[model samples]
Target: MKKLLFAALAVFAFSFSNAQDEGGSATSQGTWLIEANTGNAMVGSTAFTFTSQDGESVYNLGLDGGYFISDDLAVRVGLGFGGDSAADTNIFSYRLGAKYYLGGEFPIGVDLTGASIKDAQENPLWLGLQGGYAWFITDHIAIEPGLRYNLSLNEDFTDEGVFQFNIGFTLFL
Candidate 1:
């Protein structure tokens, strides 16, 4: 998983950096954005997990994409797969959301996320809220650092909410 993460980052770094083109605004209407997003890359959270856990080794891989329906407002969708090594469980995750870019830099978003754990009957769902700043490295790429909160909606699955710090790589087109 670590190797895969490193490889993905390398690909993004090389491809995004090399594909730079002059652009107008990243948040304009009809623009599309694709992101490689990870939570707790530097600090906060135990794993890239949406459910509550106590020090379990976990790894997640996900992609998010959005299309601007209007200037500064985008509708997005995401899909992810992860696992808990301790529990020997594989999890499938999904997210649906909207993000509004403030002045095409600061972004605030709300999302619905859920994870289905293998061999478990209960699927945990969460309401996720995040705020971040997009620091554009080029006209078409940005590195986003953010704070996120995942509020667990199902107490029977997970009673506690998750707070995560995230670093994201985005390609704007």
Candidate 2:
């Protein structure tokens, strides 16, 4: 986990060297992108928990790939796993969704995803919504900080929702 985080930071840092405007922003049409998030994942009280090596609870990391169908609309899919954490409920997740970028220089986006995780203990079915904004470091890249609210739709779990904070960068091509 630490190594991956370091490598991601290294890449982001080094990407600034000799980078010119790639002319792609969140609101740009027909653009493809890849992104990653490695920050705090705050599990809510009603959330299923994973215990780290230090016996602390945390959520997994996420990676996503997306394409802008139009200047304001994009479709994406993502995966979340490998926190080096152990839990009664192991959640290796897969999610598919779309985001619509609101009007701005660096647009704020609203997203809705249907998420499913592999839970060894029970049925693993869920969905999530996220609200975020992009702060462009370069025309081709941005640092995004976002909040997510996820709820378990399965009957075995409570109806309460979980919130997580994510920080990551997007690379446009």
Best by lDDT: 1
Q: Candidate 2: deviation at residue 78, Å?
A: 0.4
Residue 19, model 2, lDDT: 57
lDDT by residue (86-121, candidate 1, tens digit) is 879887788889999999999999988887778997
Task: Return the TM-score for each candidate structure.
Answer: 0.82, 0.69
Superposed by TM-score, candidate 1 places the C-alpha of residue 160 at a distance from the truth, in angstroms, of 1.7
Candidate lDDT values, in order: 0.77, 0.59
Please estimate how well model 2 matches the true structure, expressed as its whole-model Cα lDDT.
0.59
TM-score of 2: 0.69
Q: Specify the highest-TM-score model's number.
A: 1
In the range 87-173, model 2's lDDT, one tens digit per residue, is 544445565777666763333443433333345445445566777788777666777777776666665645666677766567766
Error of 2 at 114 (Å): 7.0
lDDT for residue 61 in candidate 2, whole number 0-100? 54
